[model samples]
Each structure stands twice: as C-alpha cells, then as structure tokens.
Target: MRRSVPMQRLDGLVDPRQGLGAAEAQARSARYGLNVIIPGVRSGWRTTLADTLRDPMLWFLLATGALFMLIGSYTEALIMLLALVPLFGMDAYLHRRTQASVEGLSGRLATTARVLRDGSQRTVPAETLVPGDLVLVRSGEFFPADGLIVAGEELQVDESTLTGEAWPVRKQVVEQGLFSHIRETAVEDVYWGMAGTRQLTGHAWLRVTLTGAETLYGEVVRSAVAGPHAQTPLQRSVAHLVKVLIVAAIVFCLALAWLRYHQGHGLVDALLSALTLAIAALPEEFPVVLTFFLGVGVYRLARRRALVRRSLVVESIGRVSCVCSDKTGTLTEGRLRLTHLLPMSNISEQRLQTLAAAASQADSGDPLDEAVLSNCPPPVEQHILARFPFTEDRRKATMVSEQEDGLLVAVKGAPEVVLGLCELPEAERRDWLAAVEAYSNDGHKVIGCAYRTLTSEAWTGANQIGG
Candidate 1:
C-alpha cells in the first residue's frame, strides 16, 4: 500500500474579494509603497573629450601627428588628424543611440491590475504594487505583482518572459521550496508582469510576495543590464587585428628610426621619418571600415525583425556553433485550440446541446471550453445542475441532475480518465486510445467527454466515485 503525502497549509493569508471603499484603496496603495525612478548621470563635454584623448590608440596617433608637424611634414599630420575625426564621431554616435534606447524603455509604463483589497477591488498602476497586497488574477490576464500562491486549484502560469522556460508551470498554494515559502500562501496575489499566462481552468488567489524592483522579473531585467553584452565573432577578430597592427607599427617605427639615424639623417628628419612610417603602418582607416560593416549588419538584422542590442553582438551570432530554442513559442504557436470533439454515446442532437451548454456555463472561461460552447444551441437554464469545477488532479468536470427518467451525468476531461470511467466496447476503446496516442505523437492535445444514465440512489460525491 502506498502512503499519501499530507497537504501543507499556512496562516495569515486573506482571500481576494470585490468591494473596497475609496479610502481603503488609497490606504492599501500607500501601505504598499510608491515606484521610485532613478535618473542616469549626464556626462559633461569636457569629460567626454578627456576620455577620448586618454585612449591608447588615440594617444599613439596624436604622438605621431605631433612628431610629423615638428619636422614640417604637414601633409602626413593633417591626414592622421582627419582619420581621428571619423573614429571619434562614430564612437560618440553609438554611445548616444544606446543611451536613447535605454531612456525610451524606462519611460514606458506597464499596466497594473485591479485587485481586491479589504473587500473592494481597485485598479492601480503596476509600479505601485507592493509586497503583501492581495491581487486577483483571471484567465487571459497578466500578473502585475509577484506573490505566493495562497488559495488556488490548478493554477498554471507562463513564466517564459522571466524564466525563459516554454512550458507553463503549475502552481499551488503550498510552499515547495525556500524561495516559495517566504510569502504566506493565503493572501498572495498575482501581478501584471506575468500577464501572458492564461487560466486553463479553475480559480485561484495570490498574495503579493514581491513588488517593484524586488520582483523576480525585475531582477532578471536588472541582471541583463549588468551582464556584458555578447561580442560578435567579427568584433573579436577585428579587435585582435587592431592590437596586432598597433604592436607591429611600434616595432617597425623603432627599427626605421634607428636605421635612419645611423644613415647620417638629422635627428629631426629621422624622427619625422619614423613617425610617417608608424602612421602608414597602422591602418587608421580600419575603425571607420569596421564601423561601416557593423552598421550594415545592424540594418540587415533589423530588417529580419531581430534587435541587436550591441553592434558587436551581431558578430557573435555568426560564430555560434549551436543554437538552443524552446519549441512552444519558438517552434510552434503557443496557443492551443480545440480541433475535434467526440461525444461518448450516440445521443440525440438535443442531448448534445444540453451537455455543451452545461460545460460552457461552468467553463471558468478556458479557451478550450469556450471553443466547445461556441457552437452550442440555447440551453434550458432551469435544468442545469451544480457545477463541479475542473482540476488538474481530477482531470475532469462532472455534472449531474435529477431527470424524469432517472439521473443524468456528464463527464469531461483527459481521454484516459473519461475512457476508464465509461464502459465502452473493447474494439471501440482500442480505437479511441489509438486516436488519442496519434494526436499526442503529432503534438496535438486531446481531451474526452462522456455521458451516462444511472439511478438517483447510485449518486455520490466526486471523492467517493473512482473516476
């Protein structure tokens, strides 16, 4: 016999409910805290100029230019100065463009959810969300705050934006680890940054465990900002080539200066000749050429709908030996649709309509259920029975009501569960199982719906029923 794991529960959590006074909402907002904006420091013109002058390559070029000017080599000095202008300008333009992009991103505001507080739900900006606030999350809604699962059944959330994991993670109120246990599961609310997750079926409430810059997604963005941008292969190779050229130029210049001096050339003439040689040996136009190549790459990548954060990163992409990608969004469309429906028995058209109507009414707005109910005819509202909410564990929803002939029961869930509950012919069962396996192998999700008739005396709660 197998032993069951006991469910864990904690305290100090509140359920989300509608109805809050204006004052209460304000108080909640105040208690949670406000969004803080940090400004970037501006660089002064003098500072920028000093930084440009401090570059080793720039210093070398300047020294060469000065030596040429001292020896009356005006043409070479002017050429070297002209080369410096474009390199400096390109560097300035790239820096300004990057700053503008970051600034624009900071200015855009993300939407916040209206969550229940002290009996009333109030809409607030996402930035205003604070830890310990109760939030309400629903199907087709984004999570505004990061919180612990307090009270929920079958809550599945898509964390691809933050975790980069394609599959939706199933969440429960109970803590699963140290990070999860930090918040009280009873009063956690889901926030908007995680809004891409859709409710498949079932209701849940979350308490705000983290907010603002402390949220998991916020941390991810922060880390990305701090992490070094990947360098492209071209950028790496170009950098290496530049270093080698500089070293070769210096060695060649020293050798020529010694040779010219020994050949009875005057100090001034020999120094000027060495400087001219250095300038010629160094590819002063390399920086300008590399900048143009990077610009072309950036334009091409942008046209393909790929944003290159750094120009150098483009070269890195060219050097990648292997690529890893998630199948859900990268390979296939993330949305799952109902492609086919199978009714268990050869029921009348009217009976089919009734079952569909009942399922629609208690669907909790899941996409799959909505699709099934879309073509359903008008249902007899009065004949509807108490709804049994769908849960991942049970994998089914059962509807039952007293009928004039007997008791009518309808069940819907994963095919395996429905098939096991229904007494179908062996051949038919094998065929249906085969169909389900085929769909699964083809990457199409499949579900089953079944209906049956029984005596009122046989009715029992879902816990007592084996199916």
Candidate 2:
C-alpha cells in the first residue's frame, strides 16, 4: 500500500464505524469511473510485427529481398524472407511473457477489500470503493484505496513501493475519536493508508477519503510507464557498420557505372552491370548473421524463464558481472529457506528441526514456519493443548502438545528471547549468544529453538508452561 499523505479531517464527515451504505456506494461508483490507470490488453499480432520490423537489420533484409525478386533470383529472395519468420516469432513470444508480467502487476494493484457497508462487513472489489467508505486492511495485503487509518496499533506498512524507502514504516492510531475531528495534523502523527502500498504486519480500519485519481498513488498511475527507443551497444555498432557498408556500395556502384558509360557501353548495360555489383557488394548477409546470433541468445534466455523485453538486451546480459539488488520481491523470490542448523551437544540435527517445526503452525502463512515445515513434518498424533502466537512484545511463540509419553512444550523465536527463557548454564548461554552474533554478522537471520519434556507431575495446563 502507498503511504497516504495526511489530509485535513473535517468534523462530521465520516462515521468511522458504520461506514457508507450500499446504495451510497453504488451511487458513488456511478459518479466516479472505475479506479483504473492504464487498462491495456495484450500486444496484438500487428504490434509484434511492427516491433520486429523496427530492427534496422530486418529493414535491410527486406530491401535486399526485394532486389533479389527484381533480379529473378527467387531462391535468394525466399531465404531473405524466411529469415524474418524467426525474428517475428521471437518478438511475439517475448511480448507474450511481458504481457503476462504486466497482467500480474495489474492484478496486485487492484484487489478485493473487506469493508463495512450498512453496518456489515462485505468483500467488495477495490475499484468500487469511494471516499467515506470504511475498510479493513491486514498484513501482506495491499491497501485498496487511499484513506486515513482511524483505529489500529503497531501498524507497519511497506511504503517502499511509493516512497522508495527500504525500511518499513510504523503507523500510530488516530488520537481524536470520531466527531472530535477538525484538525490539520502533521503527516507523521496522523496514520494514512494509501492505495498501491501494502500493509506489512498489522490490521487497521481506515476511512477512505480518496479513491482513484484522488489518491497519492493514483497520481503515479496517471503517469504511465513509458517505453522509449533504446538500443544496446552491439545494436548501435551493427547499425553503424550497416550504414557505412551501404555508403560504400552506393559509391562503388556509381563510379563503375560512370566508367562503363564513358567507355562506349550502352546506358542500360552499364546500369545493369553496376546494379549486379551493388547487390553483391552490399553484404546484406552481415545483418542476417547478426540477427541469427542474437535471436539464438534471446531464445536461450527465454528458456531459462528470463523475459527478454528486447532482443538487444540479450547482448547486455552476457556482459553483466555484478547485480545490485534491494532484496525486494522484484529483485528476488523472497522465500525463506532453512540453510543451516546449529544444534546443542545433546540435540541431533533432526531433533532440532523437529522441535522448530513443533512450535510452528503450518497454516499460519508465516515464511519461517513454512520453511521449517518444508524440511520436516510435525510430530504425528500429537494434540495441541494450547499455542501462543508471536507478538512484537513477546518476540517468541510457544506451543504445548500432548504426546504418548507426556506433554511436550516447544518454543521458537528471536535468539535473545529463546536464550532468556531457557534454563541454561551461564557459560553455555554466553557461548550460544556469541554464536548467534556470529550468524548475525554473516548476514543470516537466526531463529533459536528449544523444547522441554513435561512429566505428569509437571504438566498442569497452558499456564504451567507459558505463564
């Protein structure tokens, strides 16, 4: 979600809790068009053909092919025209990939939002939203529209999409209650939830004060991404070489024709002789050879799931040595993997992973839990008595499960939290803490794991383990 810029909140403008009625929403939707910036379809065959023909090499091929047909060399003409088939097909394939990416992006930009309509929460299309509507936004979801966060705590939003900031921004609750409103507050104090940005961690109720072009992100949407005429160095060099070859072909053809005419040859004979030499000297094969090589590069890249927007980029990729990234979803898959295991002397590597998975809820949709679950299945036939969700204050989660022998308690969280809760020798704790620091210095995200077995005498209930 984009960070919503704080705006003047007029008193009596919103109900905050009841939100707008269904009929009012329908009327507003009719007044304002759909919240779309550039609703474009896939590139058609004509567009693909046009883009392919833009290659200067292909233009030379077409001219050479026409000349061949004029000279009745049907075989050469056929070969030149046949070369165009792969160029067109390559472009069509890449454009299809590019269109799919664009559609995926558009899907993210517009999503369904749960909002209060006539005192009841209903899932509605984001584009149908209007100003004065109250909506709910949760973690890992984009804010449907631009609005002010009326009530929420510990709300963290990923404003990097809009602000270009690498860090997550925490939002505060609105200080004044409903109807105590008539103040122009600073942006930092008043929590604003804008469209096109995502909520990173918390849930919030926001009053939609702006929609479509009225929102901050809507301004970005109005300014569309432009595709300019660009060329790689290889392409520029090839084009330059082709220009020089054409000039030389023309100069030699004119000089030879003038000499033959002055030596008593007929104008038609001199012209045909010059034309024949020009056709051979033109070196039209230069472009065909270059196109074939680059087309193969584009094909290889496409097979690797790399979307080559332009064939010229294929050459540039071969020259790339280092790639600087911001570690965002666009840069990488952003999926967590259990790469290493640091077990205590008494614990086996398998036991460590089992305990970590035991503390995790498979259905939680948390990346850490999923990564652990991917490695090992949870303990079988174990009934969960109680489970504590991770919170910012606690910084850890605990779960109690009933097994055949007795009750088992498992915990996983930040290293510091786990070390503090576990009963360890002072020297052992310091050693493990030092290990954790080493992992941190190596740029690894470390999660500490611990488990405890409880006998019947000690297995009271959830309170005995956590409280």
Candidate 3:
C-alpha cells in the first residue's frame, strides 16, 4: 500500500468538495470490480465433483479399475466403479447444502452506504462504492469502505471486530500540512475508518482509498479462504494411514506381477491377477466402521447434555484443555439492579431517592434511571416547572421541580459534567471526585446527581439556563 499523502496533495487527485462525478465513478467501478469480499470460491456440484476426483483413495481405485478394463477383466472393473457411487453422492450433497446455507446468510449482512456522487450526497448499496468516493459515516452506522479522514468531529469508532481493541478510538480530522513530512502522523491516525468497524460517536467524511476485497476487512476474509481447510488431528492421521495402505498395496501388486511373469504367464494376465489382489488388499468397510463408531460417540455425548455439531470432533474431544469467554452476559447475569446510593449532603438516603425520582423521567429509556425510579416513591404535590432533555452536546439532563417549600433544580449526568455545575466547597468537591473515580475504577457506571435550591426569580429564568 502507498503511504498516506497530505490532504492538499490528495485534493489534486480527487475533488474533496464535490467528490467523483457519476461518469468517472461508473468507469472506475467497472475497472476495480464490485466492492464485495469473496472469501472463497463458491462451492457447487461441479467443484464438489472435482474435489472428489482429487482424493488419493479415489485415484488409486480409478487406476486399478483402468488396469482391470485394459486386461478385459470386466467383472472386476464394474465392481471398482460401483464402489465410488455412495462416496461421490455423499460428498456432492454435503457441499451443495453448505454452499446454499452460506449464500443465504450473506444476504442478511448487506448494508446501504451514504456517498457523494455527482457533487450530491446520496445513499446507495455499499457494494457500489468505489475508490476516491467521499463517504459519510455517523453513530450507529458501520463504515462502508476503508478510507482516510478528510473531516470529522468527535468521531469515535469501535474497532473491536478488527483489532480486538475493546475501547473506542477517538478520530480527529487532520489539518493542512499535517502529513507534509509523512513521518509525523501515524498511519492509523491518518486513515479514517475500516469496513466492519462501527462508528460509536460523532460524524466523519472519508476519502475512499480501498474497497471490495482489497479492503483490510476484506483481506481478513480472503485470508480465511486461502487458509487450509479445518481438519482434526485424528482425521489427518487417518488420511495419512489410508495413503500408506494404498502405497503398500501398489508395492505388493508389483511384486505379485513380477512373480507371475516369471511363472510363464502372459504380461496382461499377470497384471490382471495383480490388480485383483490389489482390490482385495484395501478394506472397503473402513469408512463405514469409522462412521459407526463416531455416530455412537455423538449419541453418547448428546445423552450427557453435550451437543456435537460434527462427528469428526468426537475423536478430538479429549484434547480440550481450556475454554475462554467474554465476561459480559457469560460470567455474569448482566441484569442491572440498584446496588448503592451516595449522598453528598447531610440528607438521608430516603430524601436522595425522592429527589432523584422526582427529577427522573417516568418513561425514560435508560436502564439505570429505571432502576432508580423503581426504588423510590414519587414526590407529593411536586410539579415539573421546566425540563432539559439529554443531548450528545450537553452530556447531562436537568429538571426544575416546584414543591411546597421552594423550586429545586436537579442535575444528573457524567460525574465530571455534574461536578462542574455543583457549588460544593473545595474540600467537599475533592471527596466527591475521589468517590467518582473509585466507583469508575471498580467497573461501575456512575451517574452523578446534584441539586440546588431555586428562588422564584431563578425558576423564571430557568429557560435561559437550559433547565
């Protein structure tokens, strides 16, 4: 891959303001091919049949049958040909079923992408995207293609699927001359996003550099296709053993042929007799015996509440040493419950609960808020005076409630944001911040809550302060 160039240099190659025109895009799409990843050649009856013909055992059988036919041994040739009927049928059926199942699944993951075409923004199929296209990505949307970040704001991406990085990466737009030297900026920071990664926050416009099977994620898929087929150690051993047996049978046949020729028999007759001996040398029921034992093992495992997906795995069951899994929803129940309550003031826990409940939205779609409201009773005779809905920019929610005593303004949000709005003393403020850090470090999601007493004048001006 070429090193990332400066945006100014890139601007000369493709228009950053208008992007590629429709005519040029169509021409390039035809040249570059569709933006689709072909992990492996699609399996079909023809490929399955070809693969069956490539097997070593099948080759041995075919050679033996040919020699028999050449010597006019009609009955032996027919028997050898008939032996392959069941094997070929089984191989073709399995391959066709697996291929159809994979093709059906690929349909569910196809996505629509937003791109700039003909100097206008439009949504199109992700596979239609080409190089040099300007693509827009937003929160909750997966990246359409691999590209460089031309412009962005607070853009954070979850690359867990690609890099196994659990935390979201914050992406920033590079200014002019940032890549002038090429050695200053990191490659990852220069490139915008990759396909299959999700945009977790903010928005960005990327100049598509690679698409289709050439993309990073596409390369991963391609590598899987180019990789060796999965096989158990036992299966590999059995295959090797079969090859050895076939070679030994061929050697014994040649020796028998030599002895018959010395006994004054014709060359054709000697070869025919050797071929018959080779046919008897192989165990025709080997596959059936192995299949029967594996099937019985699978049944036994099923009776013990263990589901085995493939019979080949039965032989490798004793090799399992360790199992790893994600902690969320696997090691834990993953259900939220009210665990602890912290009140910064001298107020009792009951007072805090009532205050939080009064400020909480009854139908709030947040699980934490739901847990809080469920543990507290509604405030008596309290009416909502003003409300400020939560937004990405604010990172907080505010509510003004009017009670018999006075009007109260409640704030609940990120610990840092809420702490900034509170009027606590310096010493008390440090304590609150320390508590917040402690909870955060313990892997607990903390929501800071604070309130202030508001007079009539303040309540009237609530709208100005975004209450």
TM-score-based ranking: 2, 3, 1
Please list the C-alpha lDDT of all candidates, in the order they appear: 0.59, 0.76, 0.68
Candidate 3 segments exceeding 4 Å error: 1-16, 38-43, 57-110, 165-167, 179-186, 230-240, 254-276, 283-467
lDDT of 3 by residue, 258-347 (tens): 999999998987888787887677554454455456656766876785544445567888677887967644565444566778985588
1 or 2, greater by lDDT: 2
Q: Which parts of model 1 are misplaced by more than 4 Å?
A: 1-110, 115-121, 152-170, 174-203, 230-237, 247-279, 337-389, 397-412, 420-423, 450-467
Instruction: For model 3, give the RMSD to the true fold.
Output: 7.4
- Work out the TM-score per prediction: 0.60, 0.75, 0.63
The candidate maximizing lDDT is 2
Clashes of 2: 3
Model 3's alpha-carbon lDDT is 0.68
List, residue by residue over 1-467, the lDDT tens digit for candidate 2: 33433343223544557687789878767876665533575479998887777677778888889878877789989999998887777778878877786675566464788999988999988878877778898877888877778877667676765665534566766556532543453344236887777776668888877777776765764453345658888778878888898899999999999999999998987888787887898888777787788889988987887877777788889999998866655665556788999999888999999999899987554666778999997988879988875656667778888888988899999998888877888999999999999989986789998888887678666533441
lDDT of 3 at 166: 46
Instruction: Indicate which candidate wins on TM-score.
Output: 2
Native-structure RMSD, model 1: 8.5
